[model samples]
Target: MRCFEHPSQKRLLRFISPIACLISFMVTDLVTAEEAWLTRSQQLLNTLQGQAKPAWLENNPHQLEARQQVLELFNTSKPLTDLKFGTEQSPMGKNGQPLKMLFISFSLGETTLKGIFEEASGRDDVLLVFRGPKPSQKLPALMGDLKRLLKGIDPVPNIVIDPTRFQRWSVASVPDIVVEQDRKSRLHVRGVSSLSWLDEQIKAGKQGDLGTLGDVGEIAEIDLLEEIKRRMAAIDWKQKQQQAIARFWAQQKFEDLPTAQADRDRSVDLTITAPRDLSAPNGQRIIRAGQTVNPLDKMPFGLCLMVFDATVPAQVELIQHHSCQDKKARVLYLASSMPRQDGWDSLKRLETTLQAPVYLLTPDVRIRFQLQHVPAIVEQVGKHLVVHERKVRASQGAPS
Candidate 1:
C-alpha cells in the first residue's frame, strides 16, 4: 500500500511540477525589461499577420529570418480561408504573397512520400496540402510532415482539413502533390522532391538564380529481366575454359586437333550441373559440365557440389551457375554484407551513382562468395575476374 501510494503521489507531483514551473516562469518573464522587448516583438509579428503575409511571417522573427534566407524570394500570400482541400472547393493561391500551398495525394504504399514532405518542411513559406480517401489513416502523413517542419524553427502556420475542401488540386498517384498560390503563397511540389529541389523551386518562383542538384550513386528501381542478365554476366567458368582451350590449341604442333573456328571469333558457352555425387573421395559439389579432368583416376570432369558443412569448392562458380543462367548483357548483381534491406539500399545507391542497370540481392540468401564487408564490388570481364574493394580512402584493384 505504501509503495503504490508513493508511486501515485510521485506521478501527481511530476505532472504538477511542470505546470507550476511554467506559471512561475511566465509571471517572472512577464515583469522583466527583456520580456517587454519580447512582448513587443510578438506584437510586431501579430501586426504583420495580415491575411497576405508570407507563411514565414506567421511564425516569430527567428523563424521568419531563417525562412527568408532559405526561401530566397519571399512573397506575401493570404492565409487559407478554407482549411479543407479536395473536390468541393477551388484551390486557393496568393493574390500577392511568398510561398504557395501544394495539395498532394497518393494511391498507396509510396515510400518516397515522406522524402518529399521532409524537403517541404525545411521552408517556412511553403504550405503542403495533403488529403486522402481515408482521412484517419491518411491524416497522419500530413501531420508528420507538419510536425517535422515545425521542429528547429518557428512553427509555420498551416491549416489541415479533410479531402472535401479545395478544388483544382490534383494527384497523379499515391502521394501526389498539388501546388497552390493562396494569394501570397508560392508553389510547392506535387511529386518526389528533395530539400535542394524545394529551395530551387522557391528561388524559381521568386525569379532568383537557382541551379541543379547533383545525385549520389544508388539503384532507384530494379527491372527483373535486367537483374537476371547482370547475374549471368558475372559468370566466367565457360569464358575461362574457352581461353584455356584456345591457348592450348595455339601451342599445338599438329593442326588436326579440330581446327574449326578462331578463339576470338567464338563465344564461350557453358552448362552448370546441379549437386551430384562424385565417384571420387573428395565428394562432388556444384561443378560445371566441362571442367578440367582430374589428373589422378580417369573418370570424367571433377564433379563439384555445393554442401553445407563439408568444404564447398568453387563458391564463385556456383553463384555464376545458379544466379546468371538465363541472364544476358547489361546485367548486374548487387551484393552486400550488411543485411538484405540494406543490400537493397546499397543497390539504390548504386543506381543513383551509376545511373545504370543494377539489381539488389536478398539477404540471408547466402551466396558462396566471401563477402564479409560493405561496399564490395564484383564484376566479370569476359573470361577474367575483376573486383574492386572499397577501402577507407578509395577502392583497391579486384580482390586477387
Candidate 2:
C-alpha cells in the first residue's frame, strides 16, 4: 500500500539530509588532509635524520675562546691585602685619642647585623669596619637587607672600608667587634655581641690621670683709678667731635627731590576673570562646554598636560604611547592623587621609561581645569583649553 508523507516531515527531511551529507563530507576531507600531513611530516623527519650534522654544532670554537678569555681575566684579579692591627688618631674626640676599631664583613647575616647595629646605636666613640671596597655593587643589596632587618629605627652604622684600618685591626672573620683604646691596648671579641659588653670591657682598662688645673691666684688685678681717668678723657673728646659735626650740617643747604615719571601705557590695570568652580562632591571636576579662559591675551605654544591614575596599568601604557606621539610638546604627567610607596615606585618606573616628569594633581589644578576622569590629556587650543578623557580597558595582568 502507498503512504503519503506529511508536509512538515518532508521539510524536516529536506533540512536534515543536506546537513548530514555536509558533515560526512567534512569528516572525510579532514581525515584525508590529516593523513597527507602525517606522511609529509614523516618524510621530512627521515630526510633530516639521514643528513650529516654540522661540526660547529658539536664543538663551537668561538664559545670555547670566550670561556677561556673569561677564565684568564678572573685568574688575573688582584689579591686582597692581609689584615693587621695598627694605631691611628681618632676622629671622634680631641687631644689625639686613639679610635677603638671594630672590623666587620658584609657576608654576615641580617640577624647578626641587626644585633651589631643595636649594640653600636648612640655610641659614636666606637668604629665599625667593613673589609670590602666602598660603594660596591653588593653594597646596595646589603644596605637594603639591613633596612628590612632594622625596621622603624633606621640605624646607619658608621662603616669604614679603609684597607689600612682593616689591616691594623687584623680582622680575620665576620662579626669581629674589636675595641682598641691605644696602640698597646686592644680587645678583640669575635662573633655578634652586645654593645654593653664591649663598653664594660673598655671600662675595665686602666684610666689615665687628670692633668693639674690652673691657679686663680696667678691672675693680675685691674687698676680702678687709671680706668676712671681714661673714661673722662674719652668724654671730653666726644663733646669736641659733636660740636664740629653741628657746624658742618648748618653750613650745607637742602635741595628738593626730582619728581618720578609715570607711563600712560602701564597706568591701566589688567583685569583677570575668575575661573568657574566645577569640583564635584566625589573629588571629580568637570569643565563646562564653550567656557573660555582669559588669563592671558595669548596662549603659550606646545604646553600639554597628561593626567592619569598611576595605579592602573592600562593607563600607564596609554600615557607611554601619547608621550612618544608628542615629542615636541612639553608633556607633564600628573596622577589623580599621591600614590603610596608601591604606586610611587610604578610611577618612577613609568617616568624613567617615558623620560618625563610625573607630579601629583594638586587641588588648584583640579579646580582650574575641572578634571573628572583620568587617562585624560589637556592641551591649549586657540583661546580655550581642550580636555580629552580616554577610556582605559581592564588589563588581564592588572591587580584586582
Candidate 3:
C-alpha cells in the first residue's frame, strides 16, 4: 500500500499483491491437509502394527489400535485370516509384484464376528480385518489364525508387515470384503462369500493385485514342549535345563487367559522350576517313568507325576527304599532359589511346634541333581514322599 511515485511502480504493486496473497492462502491449506492426513494415518498405523512380541503379552500393550484389531478379529462372522498386508508405504514383501491382497473391513456385533471366523477359516485367499473397542478375549483365537498363516509362508522374511496394525479398506456392507491393490487405494465389496469366490474376484481384477497375501489355511496346534525337547536333545544339559524353563510357561494352559483386576491382584507369586525329563524307553519308544504310556505314546502318567506333582512322593520312596532303611511317614518341601530366611524360621518354628522332621537343600545341590527347588524337606510316610508344597518358608506354616 506504499504510495507509488512512478506509474510503473503502481502498476507492478497491483499485480504482485494479489498473487502473493493467493500463494500464502494455498500454502496454509496444504499444510492443514497434510497435518490431518498424518494424524489419521498414525492412528490407523497404531491399530495394525506390532513389532515382534516377546515370548509373552502378559501386560497388554495399551495402544488403542492394537486392542481394536484384536477385538475385530475375534468377532468376525467369517473365519478371518490376518493378511500380511501393506501399502506402498508398508508392504508384505520387497521387490516382487506384491501379492494380490484382499481384506474385508466391517463392524459387527460380537456374535457376528465369532460366527464369521468360525465359518471363514476354511476359505482360501480371503483375510478379515477386525476393528473393535478395548481389551479382547479373542487374542488366543486371533493368534491361532496367525500361527496358521505363518506356517503356510515358512521362512518368513525378517521385516514382513504386521497386518494386525494397518487400515487398508473401507466397506459399506455387513460381512464385506475390502480389497486393495495399492495400500493407498482400497475398495469394499458387499456380500457373504466363500474363500474360493473371493479369490476368483481377485483374479478377475475386481481387486487390485498387491503382490503378497497371507495363506488362508488352518493353523496347526504346536506342542511347544515336544518341539523344545526335540531341539534340545542334541544340546548340552545346561541348555536343556534352560530350554525347559524357557518353554514352561508357554506350555501352561493359563499363560494368556485374561483376568479381572481382583483376580489378578490375588494371584500367587509361585515360581515354576523346570523338572528333569526322565522317561525311559520301553520297547519301540521311550516310556515315561511311573505310569503306563497312552496310545499316542504320550506320557500322561509321567507328566502328571513329574510336571504336576514335582516327584516328591517318588523321590521319598526312592530314599526310603535305598537310604532310609525303614518304613516311615515323611513330608518333603522345597524352597525358592533365593531363600527368605524369615520363611525358613517360620517353617522351623512350625516343625518344632508340630513335632515334624524337616530338612533343607542348597540350590547348587538342587541344580546338580536337577531338582525343582531348595530347602527340600522329605519325610517317610508309609513308603511314599509327596511334595507337600514348593517354595514354602518355615514361617509360612500355621503356628504348630
In angstroms, the error of model 1 at 283 is 99
Show the lowest summed lDDT stretch of 10 residues, model 2. 77-86
- Report the number of clashing residue pairs per model: 62, 5, 47
User: How do the residues 283-398 of candidate 2 rate in per-residue lDDT, one tens digit apiece?
Assistant: 55433334443432332324477777666667677767764234555666666643443443454476677675565555445545556667677765554566666665554233
Tell me the deviation in Å of residue 236 in model 2: 63
Regions more than 4 Å wrong, model 2: 1-271, 274-293, 323-327, 338-344, 394-400
- Candidate that beats the other on lDDT, 1 or 2, i.e. the better one: 2
Top candidate on lDDT is 2
Q: Residue by residue across 1-400, what tens digits does model 1's lDDT show? A: 0012222123223423323233223222212322332233333334433333333223444444445532321111122223222112332344544444444444222445444444544344555544322323333354464455444432233434333223343232322333434432134233444546555555665432222223222222222223334544554433443343344324423101111121122121222232332232344332334443221121111111111100111222232233222233223333221122333333344435434323222222123223333333333334322333332222323233
How do the candidates rank by lDDT, highest first? 2, 1, 3
Where does model 1 exceed 4 Å of error? 1-95, 105-113, 133-159, 162-166, 172-179, 182-190, 201-400
Give the lowest summed-lDDT range of ten residues in model 3: 299-308
Instruction: Provide the overall lDDT of each model, using Cα atoms, as 2-decimal numbers.
Output: 0.32, 0.45, 0.31
The TM-score obtained by model 3 is: 0.21
Error of 3 at 45 (Å): 36
Residue pairs with backbone overlap in model 2: 84-167, 84-168, 84-170, 85-168, 86-168
Candidate that scores best on TM-score: 2
